[model samples]
Target: MLDFPNWQNWIEKPSSIIKKLRQKLDQMVGVEIKLAEARSGPPTGMALNLEIRGEDFNQMSEAVEEIKQKIKNIPGLVDLTDDFDRSRPELKVIIDRDKASRLGLRARDIANTVRTAFNGKKVSVFRDGTEEYDIWVQLDQSFRSNQSDLSSLFIYTPSGEPVRLSEIARVDSGPSYGSIRHVDTVRTITISADAFRMPGPVLVMKTKQVLNKLDLPQGVTYQFTGEDENRKESQIFIGQALIIAILLILVVMVAQFNSIALPLIVISSVLMSVMGVIIGLIVHDRPFGIIMTGVGTVALAGIVVNNAIVMLDYVIKLRKKGYQRNEAMILAAAVRFRPVVLTAVTTVLGLVPIAIGMDIDFSRESIILFGAASASFWKSMALAIMYGLGVTTLLTLFLLPALYSLVEGGKERLRGLFSSKEIVY
Candidate 1:
């Protein structure tokens, strides 16, 4: 309901605002609030959603309450609540079958008479002009509102005798569930909360640690849902995709170089790039975005290897021209330095605007800085590439050449050792 100005105009972050609101609201008696950021993506529900499932509602509700009590005080967990609501007030009627049968009245007759008295009966239809309306008849509000009115009411028997309804049935009022939920044909109660000032996964891990200490009843178990579930699934998918990408890149490099060692040397750049990705996220204090950052890392695997491949390929060409191994590597580094630096520099420059959410308006001749919501989504990916490529570029120029030299030296030593051995036969 409360729509604020654009994100650029906000003086404080949304988290700060929610924290202030929570501080003030927590003092109010019987008041609870759930605050969430407006995001455009798949529905992930709350940051922490734990579901306690069982066939017995009573046991499941007790377990859910116990879990909530244990986790309610956890730091950074807010808006703690559950889906097991049983606060609705309802009236139940119990019928005495023997009494009703002896009076020549069936259970259906008593049910119909009580239902008609309270909910009204459609006795006839009224036609006005071209439309028809149903006419219902029932007791007035004053007469039917009190429980004592049920005892005064009468039910007609099959022999046309009037029998007091209270003699055959009794009514009791109590609290009942507002609604019930089921998952996979099993009853489930979900306890959900938002994570504040802490990562969602960390909060979930803490909650799990606390819940694991409890000995739940038989046939009752809990599982995390919502964002936790989605996060796990996404991590698995991205991990598999990253592996497939590395394998595919390795295959391509192998075919191009026609040598396993050279391709593996090129692939080492990917591992070096991963180090940069971690450094970037840590320095920026941003969580690792599973989808964006992961995809960016996979894409970086292909990009960083190009610089290594370029430098290594040129060294091979130089050596093929009769230059010594050390001389060829030195010359290749000096000759290819400009092109390699320029390639990485241009890519980093291109991603700078996106990473910082900056845009240019030619018509207004103005620069928009950190004003695009869409830009935030891709910021992780852009930074992943920029930082990764930056680090890999340096390593490609320095460390990769050393590794190539070491590998080549080892290969030559093995070849020379084999040739030096005399045949025993």
Candidate 2:
């Protein structure tokens, strides 16, 4: 394992370093290398993990090879390989049932003899002091090195008669799988790779496009697993959580204000915050971290509403004191401006250091900027809240009061219309 200095000291980005290393490593003969970035959260095995499952091993192996060939050329995909072990050499003993029966030897007896001769059978226990070991009996390596040697071995029949192994069975040598993997009692072959400069989703999308051309055999199916699978699942879960949070916030706001319009007006700040988050990510050239950013968005739903609630609540209180709607809105803005701006500014300032990965070392009496890995992990969440609260604060102070006046004016107009039409009833 290799460890490097802080990211601040690096002359080149980690992705560029990995790419150069990959180029050099690819030139080495008969070697496979997988380079992965350390990340937080549950281990997902690999960035791109696809499982091809089927009943027939031959068909699955063929499909695995075809898929590998098709995807090996995808840009930014590295360490393309599979879990199917095809390099192991195996020897098979084919018993002739007729010959064995004529020789008074059952197939099990022949198999046991072959297994014992090669794999060794535990015959007895040897005791030395308080320790014991099982003694195994088997042919030496010199006597079982080749097919000819194996065929020249002896086997005993049920009647205690010795017979030559070649008379009843044949030994064949071939390449076989070293291990077999199963999922739900069905054989599975997994192909996995790591993403280099590109994002996992983009690499997976490109791989999917290539895999669409794959013609799988009957009963053979493929599914994506590993980090790609975990990412999709996390996206769905975050989306659901965001929706539930919004709903709960809406319910609480409605109960507090006793009017749907006020709650909806406050909820508009949440939308503004979302827009700000999107814009911030784009401006900073950062990918929208699904988990961190999503959680931050949900948290923003509760926070951004505070400014709107404060302003709107003040407007309502002023109106009860016999102030006109427009006057109340203006006064509410003037009175709440300092509180709202201060709140937002303090929060944004607090997160600036975090989003930029800045830290202060009291011992060294120096400022460290962009040198913390943990800060980098949480930077997305901080930026999300900072950008979101900043935008929503402005909207709450300016646009929110205008919306309140508009809604109140519309309400009065409706009331007048209803009151004037009462005679028609």
Clashing pairs in 1: none
lDDT of 2 by residue, 1-425 (tens): 55665555778776677778878888998877776666654455667899999999999988988889889989888898888988999988889999999988898888888889988999999999999999999999999888898899999887888889998999899999899999888899999998876778888899999988878898889999888778888899999998888788889988998999988888888889999999888887778878888888988888888888899999999999999999999999999999999999999998888888786655556746565655767888898999999988888888998888889889999999998885653
| Clashes per candidate (backbone, < 3 Å) | 0, 0
TM-score computed on alpha carbons, candidate 1: 0.88
The C-alpha stretches of model 2 lying farther than 4 A from their native spots are: 40-42, 360-367, 371-374, 423-425
Best by TM-score: 2
Over 243-275, each residue of candidate 1 has an lDDT whose tens digit, in order, gives 898788888878887889988898899999999
Give residue 249's error in model 2 in angstroms: 1.6
Q: Against the unseen true structure, what C-alpha lDDT does each candidate score?
A: 0.87, 0.86
